[model samples]
Target: MRSDSMGRQLLPKRIALPIFASDALSSVAYAPDEILLTLALAGSLAALNSVWVGVAVAAVLAVVVISYRQTVHAYPSGGGDYEVVSTNLGKTWGLVVASALLVDYILTVAVSVSSGAAYITTALPSLAGHEAIIAVTLIVILATLNLRGTREAGGAFAIPTYLYMGAIALMVVVGVIEWVTGNLGAAPTAHYDLVATGGHEEGLVGLAGAFLLMRAFSSGCAALTGVEAISNGVPMLRRPKSRNAATTLALLGTIAATMMLSVLVLARQTGVKIVENPASQLTLNGQPAPADLQIAPAISQIASAVFGAGSVFFFIITAVTGLILVLAANTAFNGFPTLASVLSRDAFLPRQMYRRGDRLSYSNGIIVLSAAAIVLVLGFNAQVSRLIQLYVVGVFISFTLSQLGMIRHWNRILRTRQSGEQRGRVLRSRAVNVIGFMMTGLVLIIVFITKFAHGAWITLVMILVVFLIQQGIHRHYETIRSQLRVDDWTAKRTLPTRVRALILVSNFSRPSMRAVAVARASQPSAIELVSVVADETEERRIRSEWEESGIPIRLTLLSSPYRNVIQVILQYVRTRRKRSPSEMLVIYMPQFLVRHWWENALHNQMALRLRRALLGVPGVVITVVPWKLGEDAEVEGHQLVNDPFKRPTTIPSPSSDTLVGPETVEE
Candidate 1:
């Protein structure tokens, strides 16, 4: 739990793979579904294009993984794409990437958790229509685990992630075997006839069909969402962090590509049909499918066809699929906080985000990510179809910018002379980045052009807003630094000419006596016991107690025509400050410190108001002297030296002859 113990939290490749790769790996659950759904708009024959669409998506995923591997090697401080773009492309572009990544990270959590909730409904029909509640609960749980520390979260999530991977792998292997043996069963919905939309009845025949394919490709690119996280998380890995991270990236790319392509291939073989408007587009026996019929996701249908609907393996696959979807949010849990800490260190975010919690994790960023994800979930009602519309836009923005930065990075390296082998390697890296840039850049354009009207514009607007907010935060910090800079050391450190102390007394109590004792101990040039009184009887009682206590300070009463105690005190203090502007006026306020929360309401209302009112006054210091209210409120490991209110018999009295009058404000 100590800061020094952070080294113990370093993750090995096995654990890091699951933690950083879960999001990308889980994309196989829904990316294929998205691809098929988009393709299904053009009829079942057009839906057969799902395999090639997945192939194109996997190719981009491969290039992005390779490009980020280079990124991790070059900039392993864990700033990831933001650092890459900032260091090579400059801070403005860097901030653009940061904002984009921030928005994407939020959408990642929202989309992943929502999709997982959908999977839960796939297996448990009774839980349908409550995806928002389920998704919110999963986010809260992930946030709590991550608050404990990244390593513990990794350990907890590793099993389900691996289980999901294994489930997919098994389904793929079994589906292939069943196909070769000619025993592959058809999906439950395979019997339904799909009707192409009016414009696309011809199915991939013209410019419209090509545009639809591009749209499907963009939707399938969601698999690339979490690939960059490994680069962002190199600091969390063990020794040789970059190499381990790069290796994990390669592993993630291979596994995700394999799972996605295999699922798509198997979906084609098993004739799995998914459509956006299932009630309208699908027909059974020449009749429209029932409006209330629930359509299972592509993966669930594939699992049922390959492993039998009610089999144990079927349940295991669906269960693990749902769990991995939920755990995919863990990737954002790890990356968002780390990225936020970097931004905070750079003064783009609040300094509190840069601080580690007791468990040595960025607790503020995790909680913030959780809250944002929950809001998005509730706002969209936990519908993956809707949330996915806003998903990949930000991530691809970061991707395109990072690859461009990497190319620039290599160019800078090549400007300096290198040996033959080194030059060859650098050129190869640059070439890879170039390919990555073109691929991701093209994908970014396509995604924006295709999805802009379908809620991607919301993401773009959010990114721009985040960018402007960070710029403002940075400007604020810069302004503070400039203003607080000490140009003249002597003048900045010089003490006030005289120290004048005033104790605000309401009645004769131990707390008030303690405040008076503290004021006298300060040995100020002048001291006064001041009271704001509206009632003559109360003033008389306070004067009586002061004389009986034998305190050497002069007692001054300020009369309040109205019972505005705080206003009366403020007027008196401001008038004195106007009279002696160069001296420091220290106001000692006695307050009771209670142990219970409700007890706060019973006390300190006046002290709170007085402190707030005096805060803006120049040359005024409000000092709160807390008197503990309970027996157990003693200072730890030490007893009180003596009773603070035990009045000293030999107190040095002030040179004043008598107490000031109620109208002392005139002087």
Candidate 2:
């Protein structure tokens, strides 16, 4: 089906919430695991500090959310950080943020799909070892949904997203009430001590122990992964796009922070324990548990403790949690393409990104994002724990840069509007962005220092690679623009003085006749037909067909011992140019148009190849003469012969010696 227009594609906040907020909501599924796992390395007391670490993350989330709200209001063009940075700082910094966001969006899909797959294995133990395949398949499914346009994909994902929000909120409420009433008991592994190793046996204390806390904080910051999606996707929203986007950002932040804190509290109260290595680090019944013992995720444990294991509530939570995690990738699918579109508009990406596909979605960008996520899935073997280390670096980089850009943006505006109500808002916005930048800058440092050895360096490398690629694309566009610009109007503009047409033909087909009529109707200086001779028998058969057609043009045969039609045409064109070096030579070839893609391979497309070779010849041109299948061949050819005054006229073509050469022209 054909897609709707851009106006029809605009999404209301209700639909946009799922398309953009799913990533932030789904982080609750695994953000708790990261915090608990990272802290569990520092013994039980530090692991018990999960809530405190979450509070720290949530505080930063508040600042960032407020900052982005201001961003959407101030700049509603949907360029997000790239636009902010480009307008405030410079285009170079804009590219840096773009590159970082590109990497972060790809990582969001990779990490989200991987975690979703892990939840699948958690729910179905028999499906173990197939996580990567399941994850890739999920990516393909998400890609398909997104390619169907923005609103369609948003509607498809809305139910599960709202379900996830309700489920998580209910789980948190039920979990808290159960613990308060002493109805929910400790988790299955609540009594198992987290045996510490590598100098963390004495619990968190002193500088050595403080670094572990920072590591956990940095890991917990994964909760903030998709916080900027709303800002990037402001253009896709309905009327009052900025206000709706800002409201969505605020709602995302509030829900996410609440869920994170709720999950953290429930985990703590139910004595849920998550560790990085279940094989060696975990113990049961005062001894090492079975190596194959399935450690339920923190959320799953909380769900189980709140509503008895295998209960309908627990299964519902588990099911929707997995769904939201997979749907989280949909956020990237929506945001990445929009951001890629902005980059394309600025000439930092391919022009393909600027066009919407049949469904009014950025289908090329979606395909490219899916391909990158699949590569990452296969590369990292679909291990969420492993892939997560490479997750937040790029996002925090974007966060820091985006905040800095917004601050600069406000300052620039404030200077322009010296004394007005607008200046007050600009100053307030600058304060928000300032706080956001400082906080995110600290997190970036923590992420780099704590996770660099783990895997964050790989993300930095990716950002650099993407940045360089964007720079390359920018340079290419700049070169093309420079070449197109008229430097010296009189000296630079070279006008063609004469025109001649050469029609290449294999047989007197309809395509050939159409080309002959067009060339004659245009009335070129002269006309000639070119054919490459592979063998006498084949050439004789063509000659017999041409004589029967009764066309006036003389046929010239070029030798092709190698049976290379392109080579024969190029040699003949070069020889003709040498003989008549004045006229602007036009090479026209007849082509049969096929209705099906597979029909292309079935046909021998010699004229197509001949066009490419003849393009390089100086003072020459190429034209396609397409003829439809099942059309009369002789009608147009005979029409051209019958036109009384359609005689080939002679024109005095000027030689290149009369043309001013660059070396002889005045600068």
Candidate 3:
């Protein structure tokens, strides 16, 4: 209900790194595998080139990180790519990037959780085939953690991120020491021969080889998936938000590139051979490898080779890598809701997403993202390889649009600037943006060519659908705004000059009597008690009771042959409005306020229908005169009063010289 706590400051550099960079940093755990997996299509010798591919990917990642650093510094209000594209290009381009980023953030959660589940299943064999269940459970847990608020979720991720970094650094150091001492050993799978599938194994070696290399490069681009996340999170950074976010982005790029390159190098040096189906594709001494021979992850293999099998350090590295991959989705958690909030404010999404929960986080957005990711995980059976195909495309789509946007952003600034430091900065940033636009656009093209058939098209379709939905939402809000506009006619319209009150009576009970009393106090020009004669016996008893009370208001009966109370009253109100559209008809319906929840079932649903019908008739008002039962009155004394009818009466009556006491309305 409160405006989101803007008093919350940005993240400092130390905290910002883990908060914004965890996704990219954690990709080192999987990027090596992806590179090797893609090249393995061409056979083991082709995968031997994976180290070079990793380096190329690392270079691209460095360029992107640097480009985004400039982006963050230039537009630190934290619209991220959407802001960049919208400002530089146009609103439509900005919307496209926003939609792409939204889709990517969702895939990030699904892929990260599924990958984490795979690692867990590898660690615990009994959990096999339950991957979807485990993945969804992890998502739910993460959603709950995020719902608790951003700071707590960030704190939860901090340790795992640092632990992952420490473990990878230790592995790298140990691997280097072993290599220098000539003691580095081959991985357990190194002795197995890898049988390549697909036409990639054909040694045509010319343009075909170049295409294969492009494919490998495209696969390795997975490392760059989370690079832009830091820029999206600039608002979460501390004072000097731009500077802190840039530093965090730099640290993220350096560490991630180092870890990924080292893993690839170590895998190559150790003669590691990873296959799609290890049990069938791997051969030992010209025979198929054992079916139960678990193929450890690329990082796990490197860890074991450096630290020796079954060592504590090996287990530590394995556990930490899995933990960090699971927490990697936390980056999406932070980015998705913030971006959703921005979109919602722009009317491109449901405004509910902008409402924060008790913990001051966008709880609705978190739940929505988690639900979407779970659907993808279940639909794809939590297979990381297939999900990986659907990745990179969205990230690169955003990347291309954002860079182009930044170029435009800088040009606008340049036009107004003179030969000063600001001008130099703008020119330098423009150069970075230009380079980024070309590089990202080319990679996007490669990704589409290499992966579109492999399920990347699914992501594109999803982005289009999201874009259309956003456009629809914007149109819907626009339509509603047009409908609700207040013009001179609306402002100058006068309330009805007179009130004609009617008390709906049945059997002349205490409720009906109270309705009449409240209606008379309003000083209506004409007051009457109306009852429906659905049955002769009931109508006779009501008339007898009314005559016995001898009330001042006249009692009248309307015969209903079809026994329809709502229809009869609605027809009468319509006739009255037709006769005197300028006069207000106040229908006082006697109702009982009950104490227990189930007691609501005891009442007729006719009141709801009557209220809806009356709203459409001009100059007609429906007031519910609630007669509290004894138990309801007692319960009301104990509970907070939120019911509109039961609120303390504020309007003064002409007969009362003094104000009514609050206690008078308590019953």
Question: Over the stretch 338-431, how does candidate 3's per-residue lDDT look in tens digits?
Answer: 8999899999999999778888888989999999999999999999989989989999999998888888888888888477987987888789
lDDT score for candidate 1 against the true structure: 0.89
Question: For candidate 2, lDDT tens digit of each residue in 1-667?
Answer: 3544788888998898888989998998998899999888877888888999999999999999999898898889988888888888898888888999999999999999998998988899899999999999999999998888788888899999999999988988887788788898778778787878688876678776788889889988999989888888998999889999999998899999999999999899999988766656777677876677778888889888888888999899898999999999999998899999999998999999999898888999999999999999999999999999999998898899999888877777776837777778677778888899999999999999999999989998999999999999989999999988997998756665566677887777667777776676665666666777677686677778766766566666666767877766777788878987877788888778777788999977766767777778887888886766654554344644334224435423223332221111011
TM-score of 2: 0.88
**lDDT values for all models:** 0.89, 0.84, 0.81
Clashing pairs for predicted structure model 3, backbone only: 10-237, 10-238, 11-236, 11-237, 11-238
- Cα deviation at 439, candidate 1, in Å, is 1.2
Best by lDDT: 1
User: Per lDDT, what order, best first?
Assistant: 1, 2, 3
lDDT of residue 348 for candidate 3: 96
Instruction: Tell me the TM-score of each prediction against the true structure.
Output: 0.94, 0.88, 0.88
- Write the number of the candidate with greater lDDT, choosing between 1 and 2: 1
Off by over 4 Å in 1: 535-552, 630-667
Better of 1 and 2 by TM-score: 1
The true-versus-predicted C-alpha distance at residue 144 of model 2, in Å, is 2.4
